[model samples]
Target: MDDSEADDPNRTSPRPAASGGWSRLSASRGFLLLWGAQSVSTLGASSASFVLTLEVFRDTGSAVALAVLTVMSSAGNIYLAPLAGAFADRIGHRRAAILANVVLATASAVMATVSLIGPGRLLGLVYPLVLVSAIAASMLTLTLTASIRRMRQDADLTRINGVTTLLQRAPVIVAPVVGAALYATVAPAYVYVVDGLTSLGCVAALLVVRWDAPPLAGPRRANPFPGARDGLAWILRHRGIREMQIGFAGLNLFNGLGVTATTAYVILLADRRWGSASGLAAYNVSAAVGLVAGAALAG
Candidate 1:
């Protein structure tokens, strides 16, 4: 297929044989690279997050401080998602993905520099950086998700999506443990360094993959706000989508609250009672295991 045809989600292309299954999907080098890159980047990002949480709690010793970080990150994701989508739609998905990862890498590098130079009272700087990283991460997520369909045939989308979901959740199980080990052994600045390297790795992977440029739009259509507004209008107009969005919004609200509270509580408890970072890591590991198990059962 031509590159444009490959990227066109609405193209009337013939489906590949279902019997090929995992083997067929595995044979696609680009897809394999994409998958592996995402897995590594996810793990790195999760580990960095775990380390950041520990650092923030250790420094400030305030649950409110942690809450602020969480709130800012979530706000960035929510507010920027539509704009991110519009951006990916304007640029090709591959370009957008590369751009996002580059931004993430830059952010990580800056955080590392900040940590090394003046680790004290970092909340002032860390908060804004986290917000920027969150927005870039959101953009990366949107681009990668959109690229999935272009990488494989329709028959494999369900399988690929399941794999992607697993990739998203599975890293949590190991990240805290890994982060704790790294945080204990090396300088915390190095943790951000690792995160930056992983992001660069993703950028390299994207660079090697061949992608067709997206079609250009007129000046009016090029504006992100119009597209975002139209998307919101469409979502509101659709009963099923609107209802689903509402349900997920409510679910995520409580989920975010519980997660932040539990994390803060566990960290504090571990520090005050157990007197070690290992306890916090253990709690995170157990929570992640439970989440994975619950998801498996539901599926």
Candidate 2:
């Protein structure tokens, strides 16, 4: 491609290149707004998830409850991935993203209400709400990524993805301890309230930010299922994505159980000796430190 075409902002799905770092991305105000919104949402969701874990373990003290909660949170996202992608493609990513935020905000409100009713009394409802929130969150992430791809070059996408991963992991470093402390000092409902309000902040940012939406090839058909099927077929034809998907499938299979089991194990350890919150927070922070180190190295 010539210089003009290479620099064209309207291009979609450009081939990957070695773009310059944060300087290029930061120059775009729209990207900054999206990044900032996502940062706030990530922090809120991270802290809320931590608090939920604490609440469930504190009440049931059963590994099974934690396992069930983790499964519900993940299963919905896995099941909805293709549908969410198709939905984003059908209605412009911005609209889909806004819709996802609305769902997340509403889910947070419902959870807050559930907390007020007491988690034990409303445990059944809580599981479904968590699943809903997870599904919305996955949709929001997919749409935001599609927005990024539409707005920036592939090289810029790489840097932005790195930075975004850092933003997402940054919360894991502190949210656990902060959430646990808040839960112990205040009430669990407050954590949910904070998360809900932060999500509103993200929605506000999304509303004001402006970007060019990529045009669809044609009008979406009445049924999205076929489009979703085509997308899956496309992925299957790509060796890299196919392999990556297989790897992720295996990773999730093991990682999911290990993660939930570790939480239960740590809580049990804390219960046997030290304070529960501190121990759980320490373990979380420690793991997050490794993640931060890895991110820094990758950057």
Candidate 3:
């Protein structure tokens, strides 16, 4: 997804299970299903992103508005961040992951459905519906991510984390190419339908999973929201996480400007070299493949 790793850089950061008995790579049957669900949902996520960005420009023809998608997503992340971490830590990870997946699937479906109906953008419904759904999807996405992060035990941390990131991102690389081709071949509307179908696939994966997920213990239970400071309090205490926040703050600015600039850039460079939607999709896929390979090697 274009928004890949945007919410929490640590979302894919290593988080091997802090405690467990097995030296094996897996946690349980349920967790396995959960992981599979995440991978599939994420596939649709990137595919939708490619098609959606194309749709935005195709409809509005504004690099500026297309760039604003980052701002809209950031707003969602800000609103969700407070509760996201605490919810992951407090509620059973399995529960949080399942509920979040459901929420995201619903949101994805709404956005896709609105696009499919063809309101002509005269009513101005498509943009708002997609934005709202994006907000909800992001919130739930964080919880699901945390659950995946927490499932594996200590020894497998780096490898599992890398695999998860790869799983989350592999689609980002491949789906867009498929999406661009799909767009060239069919109406743009089908992309959203595919997205909706993938979300359901994620639900199916979730259903198949069978983790005996437990809740976080004592000090970790400190709820920091709804006036409870315990959860928010600890994150603030960590210099590293705080720095992560700062880095992302800067990234949003860079990314916002960069997306628009890329539009201009491709336009400028097209005389000598061209990066059409399909071309861009190919580039992204190659880069993500490189990153996935790197992560695998590093681990």
lDDT leader: 1
Writing each residue's lDDT as its tens digit, candidate 1 over 1-299 gives 24655775433223335586653444366666776887888888888888888888877777778888898898778877878878777776767888999999999999898777644487788999999899888988887777677666787789989988877777778888888898889988998999999999998877666444353456536467765678889999999999999999999988888888888888767877764468778988898898888978998
1-299 in candidate 2: lDDT tens per residue?
23543455533332233364443443466667777878878888888988888888877877888888888877767776767777777766767788888888898889888888777667899899988888888878887776666556665677877777777677768788788788779888888888988888878877665444543566677674776688899999999999999999999889888988898889888867777777888888998898778867997
Query: What digit string (tens of lDDT, one per residue) describes model 3 on residues 110-150?
Result: 66665565424522565565555565566556766655545
Clashes of each: 0, 0, 5
TM-score for candidate 2, please give it: 0.78
Pairing residues by index, what is the TM-score of model 1?
A: 0.81
In Å, residue 208's CA in model 3 sits off its true spot by 2.8
Candidate 3 lDDT at 66 equals 59
Candidate 3: worst-modelled 10 consecutive residues by lDDT? 5-14
Please report how far candidate 1 places residue 107 from its true position, in Å.
0.7
Assess every candidate by TM-score. Answer: 0.81, 0.78, 0.68
